[model samples]
Target chain A: MSCVTPSWSVAMKKNQLRVNEFGLIERFFRPLAVNNPGSASLQDDCATLSVKKGYQAIYSMDTMVEGIHFFKDDPADLIAKKLLRVNLSDLAASGGHPRGYLLALCLPHGFPLKWLENFSAGLQDDQTKFNVSLVGGDTTSSNGPITLSITAIGEIPKGRVIRRAGAMVGDDIFVSGCIGDAAIALKLFEEIGRAKTLKHYPSLYNRYILPEPRIGLGKLLAGTATACIDISDGLYADLNHICLASKVGAKIEMGAIPLSICATNIIEKNKDYWESVYGGGDDYELLFTANKDQRNVIENFASILNISISKVGCIQSGKGISILDQFGHVVPVRSFGWQHF
Target chain B: MSCVTPSWSVAMKKNQLRVNEFGLIERFFRPLAVNNPGSASLQDDCATLSVKKGYQAIYSMDTMVEGIHFFKDDPADLIAKKLLRVNLSDLAASGGHPRGYLLALCLPHGFPLKWLENFSAGLQDDQTKFNVSLVGGDTTSSNGPITLSITAIGEIPKGRVIRRAGAMVGDDIFVSGCIGDAAIALKLFEEIGRAKTLKHYPSLYNRYILPEPRIGLGKLLAGTATACIDISDGLYADLNHICLASKVGAKIEMGAIPLSICATNIIEKNKDYWESVYGGGDDYELLFTANKDQRNVIENFASILNISISKVGCIQSGKGISILDQFGHVVPVRSFGWQHF
Candidate 1:
């Protein structure tokens, strides 16, 4: 972990201290640990985590590197939040509530100091919203691209985690929130350029830059969802995940897929945009299967949570994910890119 | 972490598949998760960690960047092992036994696939030795140095963790194994150059390459030691951590500090090397403090565990670590570099 104890003591002097590695911790990292009692103010070697009795501690990690996962000039705060939310989404899909997280940051040489201030500010905002504390982390400077990894820790009651393996034949498939906004946003940025895309379609751009992790809804789906996953690799791609794990196939009606007004408008004008609506990724929305009889219970959940839920498909007794037309014609989309005619 | 579900299914055909992200996981990573039942063969969203009913889950994380933490040409196996051991040492120092770990790897473009085979081989060797499993991790290609981070999870009995804050005045300070081998090996590499140094002192070279985390001895010292820390930063620097955290100072008898035969010979020829003996780092040995009355019991532990135990100092009621001369004269080393000369 970088160097924990200094060569000789570099006493922290608030605000005026030089921005060395130690100063970064005192100014930007230490305050994040206040919510986690086991963090020991990021002083000791390891953090002590007390997992509640009968609950299993759970965690998922994701790493983001500048120029790869995100643009170098993207707002540092949004980048930080997206890194956190994406990992939180993994735990959320497993029906867990986050407790704390550990961060490992490799800062490239000559990176702007103001970016870090904004980055930590973003972590502060999300920690409050997600009810998580910064436990401990390692920070070091590198001569390469800026890299960040966060391991988000949470807990779920034993045996209650909604997994990707429990979907059964005839189970109704559902998705949370609007899908394809992020992937479409990225497509627009690629086609029309980022500046124009952001100016004309800011909502889609915002969806790409910031994803909302559905933790509350995921926890609510614990016993209800026969199988669950977060839609990170597009609807059809993630649907295949459930199909493969459960040894079942999925038939999704292309007409029933939900989309944001922005995505719907764009797709209507350019039929090619419909490709992104089905096959584009980075949707941090929950996708799951439940017994067909649970429709009323699931609908009530959508109304109560005030997020749209759409029944777009059903599990079938076979192998791959099929994108179906309104007339029940199946379009093969597995083992290859979408085989749409 | 990594985009787990593939875009389109690329069914694996043994060694013939292209080395894409999914192929890498199927070939190198899936086996690592077999021991952890909750890992679900590394196919699920998050790993479920079961903390023993009466124990608290503990974890520590470390990130090592190529060219910073290790030589670019260092064996891939040793680099992977060092990364895991350094993190395990933290949990070891806290009176815990590791259960599993999560790894995040950022591989530079063109990094050889062969290196990963050796790296995972190293992890397999250590996991067998330490009884830990790989829970989950993320791997991605990066334009930067290969940055690796491991978050090790373990458990310690409730209310029994030996924290750095528990050291008290009059406690006998103890250290495990030899102290300066790593720093001196690094110094030798810098002075005599790597080839000649490796030819001459392979023991010291190996010592620098692979640190033996004191997991067995650390677990043995659990209730016996009042406070503890693993020496990653040099002896004096790490000692200062206990002093700062416990609000106590230390008086170290230099004559009592243990040294290896290799270090002793080096110090005899060049007294300048003595600086690193006290001020150098990467000694993953446990440095601890126990009540003075427990001297006999501690001695018995050394004999039982078959590792040398040196009582080099005592906790004192003030602040800072004083390195004492043969005649018990204190040398000032508080606010600056060693004033020992």
Candidate 2:
């Protein structure tokens, strides 16, 4: 009889150090879900989700692929955190509080057990930090580099969810935290030979790798901000989204835009580099528009949250986005932000 | 001056026919989501989900990879339906009715636009058929084969969800519809040289590609069936899941195991083929256990749903499963369905 090796046997041969999918899940994923009664210890095919009374759930999913999203040699722990944080950022923009998330991992053959262990460790850390739990997910082998998808569920009080289309003319456009650190850091990483220069901006590099989702600020802005969005596809592109959705326009003042010390230092040396600082993506900062009358209230709220807020622009009656210098002349931008096709 | 190509330009170069991801979403995905108010016309990053009063949401996620799960040439429509159906099946097994789902697609570079169109059409068909809608999802490019992950949401009355561990000793083990068709069809396809034999089992082949989730039957069985699971990993393996979860054992009679005429003919040719029929995977039928006293009630419910219900065994107070032939002799099965490594 000709022996025919099963597909799974072939998989085992390639990764002798790898635990089977089920065992891996049982050891690493099940523990993260213990607090979630609906997860059923990851034993059942689906999990049950409970929503708080007078609350609606917010849902969002994002995918990260190796090489395209991050470097192959990046630490698994950071990857896990970045994946969850990005989705959490969505909730932040919508004024939702993190509740739980589902994860789907597609790993190439010979994927390491240690990688999964570290990834789960990262998730455990964030689950505690964000006060959310793992709901349910699936792990499978793929023929390509590692790809991950996270579906995050957050809760908002009934009819209280913030949206991107509520900005009105004359609304004050504000941004939380410093913008462009992630974009600059990403640029430094892409120019692999610029390792020497990257050492000068450690903070920017850290910001790119691990973004802090402004959940606190977002919750505070729910009833106050007229419109809101998290900065992922750069400030300009994302601002354009609010404009498109609200059928309005915006003019950002370059001088008033918040920048970290490191970003200021880089821009001072090469003023032309401002495009990358402003239009490069992955900031994860909250960009929102609020009634000008609420300026003082918003400022106090930002202080309470201990996050920097900048009134960089105003919503106008027209469409599209424009950037202005301190003298109020429109400055043409090279590109809007990172575009994934 | 050396002209440096922007990252987005590089992506555009690789997929000349592809539009930017945002525009692609607007054209293809947004239409399907328009009906769901919470989807926000796919404008905002996250979608809002409003659960009915006195109901808890059920969530499940599953991933399918090209080549690993389906052939490269598999019709996009079938692939899309399969992706949704598998997750829907999970909800059905959990006694939840489909409400909505979030999909994440990681398509290979140069993936066809027509394929995506067909895939969306399939989703539209199933959404109408099953009364579910697309709430939200993310789409991105991958360097490898296509990979898709779906997170399906369903709802059931608060505290009324079915589970796998509720079976009691002496409970009647039941399954919906005929078994082994998908597995047999998969085998026939794998041995491509025997394409002539596959023509004889058109029904089996169809079952393999498109599984009709017994949603109506599952809903009817919700509070009545003591324990339940969907039979994706063959009858024996899934039965073992219910057995393991309920801490019970079972004995299934080979003669009583329901099979279509095509499966019967194949098994008759080789009595050993019974292992494949009973131990093969991807059946997508519901394997449930109910109290023996509720047999008439379950039969009546099955009749109302117009689906076949077979009682193949009884739960015993033990720790494993056994297969017995018509003459009461234990049958030696080789394996327990498909085990993904």
Candidate 3:
């Protein structure tokens, strides 16, 4: 993967007021807790949460390090939104409803307080958008680049939450939104103004920065989908999780996999880009499987949610993922998906 | 705040085997979930947690960074134990019982898989000791030093949780266990061989590395203590939090503050070290406030728990923490506590 450092010029500000940790929290993060009674206004050592009767809680945590998961120059709000949304995406894959989240921010000493303010504002925006609130967190100084970690909490009915091991043979493989836009957008980041297709479809740039999690679709698929996962490490990599966990195989038709128009144009321009389009990650879309009989109900759900739902493959009584070409033959790929290592 | 980089000579090993991300997780982390049904053997994107009926869940997060939180050459196992125990300490402050936790680990590329093995072993040890399990987390490559973040979840009876804002004016400030051992030990790090006192009190050095969270005492204080907090950011700084939150002040007698024989010996050598002894952090002891009448009950609780309980101060109807000398005059200090900034 190409590593391009974004312009940090805008983030370099002057005359910023120096603030201590407590002051930073009070001025910035406290407002995000306006609606969460359990947060206790960030006063107590721990936040309080009450699970409703007959429901189980879903917990997940992810960390994003500067220059690795995101560029240092990325907008604070977009970064915040991406952090929260990615965790929510995990909850979505689990067929759970978002409730609240905890954040741990490790910043370099002398970090700009304005950046903290913008980051908090970003969280505030998403706290309202996703109906989740900030509950508790720790703020500490790091000797390295900025790192943010979040643990998102959600709720699901007991015995109803979907797992990767639940996929069965003959289940229809489905995806909630277009795949690979984030990866393609990241590729075009190097080409930017020189790419003709990007001139017409500039939204792909924002797609790489901020992913739209399929929360409503996931909730809708709670009863319909047999197995589910979020596409963060590319379709093949994530699908392999379900395959390995369920002890099943899958055959995804390369031509049937949904793609954004911009991704299609880029892939058509160069066959080499197909690898990234198929294997690159960070799509944050739901990849799931359901019984063939539930196709009509899923279609109705997609229609009601006004989102695209594609049937791309089927679960087979085997192991590993196969990409079936347009000629109905399996085509081997160089890599499955993004590997952090 | 002396920044001493410890020797990394022991951490470096030859011909260390390389492992992919998934392989590392499978070999190192999966076993930590041996008894946690909700962990699903670390396969699912989210972990399942069911809160018992009539109970409220408590959530908290804390981060530890190499060089800042711990020396870069520190044993991976000790680092892991400290990370989990710190979060558990917070749960203890809230009068919550340990349940489970999620961890996010960011390590530099080419990090030794052996280090991961030792780190997982450390977590396994604490999971057994604390009865908490690892549910879910994200492991990603970092460009800088190792960073670890954990979000611990705990359970408490409904409406029986403790907070830092419930202390009354006449409440007595009580602290569990000895304090300043960690800070004093940290101060002695540079004088290891030169200081004869450290040779006599080697346990203080171990106390600095490993903190024993007062889980039983905290549970006992749930209904009796008015307000409670864990002493991670020094006693004066944390007590000031309760003062600010509960709109109260405190007058602590310097002579009455609990201290181990080792800490007492170190402080007796130099009166100027009293600031760190009093306001230095990382003790992880429980500093709480309770009605004067509940003193005997607290002593009984401490007796049963086999821990020391000391009443060092009384909450006043004012604003800041006042440290009284042996002669009843206020002693001005250089710093309040450990400040992240």
Candidate 4:
């Protein structure tokens, strides 16, 4: 049977042209006000926020558009939840505690109220879970697809924030959680329709739809990790980031990669499994490198935190990233990574 | 002559898929290696920033998309500059000084490299002018209109950040600069063939393309203005935000509104003048309210700053907004303001 496609065009057919953005702001956005102690309210010229007395703030923004990032028929709540989470993932990678976020939403005309309600509910859930507040946002209507932009702010102890350029030549690289599950999940969802079988295993599909940002691990690794990044693109591509930023290189053992059982199963069932593992996107894992001696400590910390930590590679004194096969020979690998532009 | 209208469908082509946002971290977004004492290199997991050691950070985000917020033919440099300035306007409205920002760009495949070079140049200009450094960003290709999301981080002295809820019952409301130029400029551009007269006034057209964010005024009014907001939507709707947030109403003498010479000229020549002044959007002026005692100081400051300041109205005890006609009577308005949805 042909899979049912979501009709985004139908979902977006409304009299949005007749109404200007300001009117919508007065009607819908104003009523959902939250009193921010740092700033007076969203109605002000700009929000004035008070960060903690001594700590510095970390800020990041991410935007998603319908039919560009995800299917139009994708669940509205999931889309909203992912938008916030992706931004939070940035904060997490920065090793900061989520504090607050600003949202800018441009909705296509004819968006259902149900979608708004679900989206807001998902936002509320994530906000409460991450201990973040919604400070301010702009909601407007458009003649195009629905788009969401979220700017998240977080605070970290003075001098404790980590960055991407600190990797030493001998630092051991590590990634949290099994790799490639999200990409594999997307494949499964696309191939099998509905993802009903994976519903019983929420870990796989949830990772694809709603990633669990590694905020705690990121914070814990702030002063310890030599360099770090969130794995949104595939693992190899993400690690290449550390390599480029630190002016170093990396060598990963293909056999040591931590793959989810479900991911392995799906990959075994499909001939193009490599694509899911190497080129899949939307995995919000943190890939970092630490001093070689800190390996045992990182392992212990991961165990204590009940999160997976895999020793996938090590930093070297060269440029570019390389993956070693089981025979310990340098293998020619395609630059398998996701690109936006 | 017929206007050259780019087909919306052609303008919406997607770029090559990017699967490696992290991979380019080193290649594209590395911090300046020389490191100023203030530079927070991308070394730690997150940026460790010091906001005057004691001040809190203010944050805001804004996103713009092609075919929605801007046209395909819009100059890329102006687009980049406006995106950052708009976010700064938000900070200015809140009484904060810009420190840094994160950017996320989703570009279509056909986006010209020259466009990017010009866009980056514009960003570099603003970064220097505003003392904001680009800390990090994600770039991806999309199968849709180009989208940009900018998240700005700013600092404000503790207890000095202004908000919208502080307006007093009798505070005088003011706006910086004449309004309606941007709206008229857009109209002129849309009807350029028939409105050949507009080509002679490039400054008026520039208003629509490049809006000066009122950061200086925002910071100046931080300690003075009881309530403030950036006029993105229009006079009526944005001010209504201050009224709703401050739990007060306002009565504006329509005659006192500051209209640009260009706007006045266009209004006199056009049939729908009131619509342009009252409903035209994209005017990035600061609309603020202050205690009556501070009026002289504000006027002097405006003079010192070389920006026009107009007192348009006063806060009143009520729940909604009203416009006073020449005879000093409340007249029924057609609509409150523009609505995007």
State each model's C-alpha RMSD to the native. 4.4, 3.0, 5.8, 6.4
Model 3 superposed RMSD (Cα): 5.8
Q: Judged by TM-score relative to the true structure, which candidate is superior, 2 or 3?
A: 2
After superposition, candidate 4 runs with Cα above 4 Å error: A1-36, A39-41, A189-203, A269-271, B1-48, B189-200
Least well predicted 10-residue stretch by lDDT in candidate 4 chain A: A1-10
lDDT of 4 by residue, A152-236 (tens): 7788887777777788898998989888877777666666664563665567777777888998898888788878888876787
Local error of candidate 4 at A304, Å?
Answer: 1.6
C-alpha-based local distance difference test score of model 2 = 0.84
Ranking of models by TM-score: 2, 3, 1, 4
- Residues A255-340, candidate 3, lDDT per residue (tens digit)? 99898887888788887678765777888889999999999999999899999999999999978888999999988877577666
True lDDT of residue B253, candidate 2: 86
Better of 2 and 4 by lDDT: 2
lDDT per model, in order?
0.82, 0.84, 0.83, 0.72
Give the clashing pairs for model 2: none
Off by over 4 Å in 3: A1-17, A190-201, B1-17, B190-201
CAPRI quality band, candidate 2: medium
Write candidate 1's Cα lDDT for B130-174 as tens digits. Answer: 899999988877767889999999898888788899898999999
Among these predictions, the greatest DockQ belongs to 2
* Candidate 3 lDDT over residue span B1-341, tens digit each: 00011112224345442555677678888888878999988899899877678888999899888877777666889889988998999999999998999889888766777788889999999999999998888888777888899999999989988999999999999999888888777666655531453476678756766888888888888999999999987889999888888989998999999888877777789765677667678889999999989989998998899888999999999788889988999988766777665
Residue B311 in model 2: shift from native, Å? 0.5
Q: For model 1 chain B, where is the 10-residue window of minimal lDDT?
A: B332-341
Candidate 4 local lDDT, B1-341, one digit each (tens): 00011112244334322223333344344442123233344433344446786577777777776765666777788888888988898889888888777777776555565676667778877777877877655565555667788777788888787777888899999999988777666666666631463456677767766888898898899899998888776778778878988899999998898987777777888856566566566788999999999989999889989999999999999888888878999856653444545
Interface RMSD of each: 6.8, 5.2, 10.1, 11.1
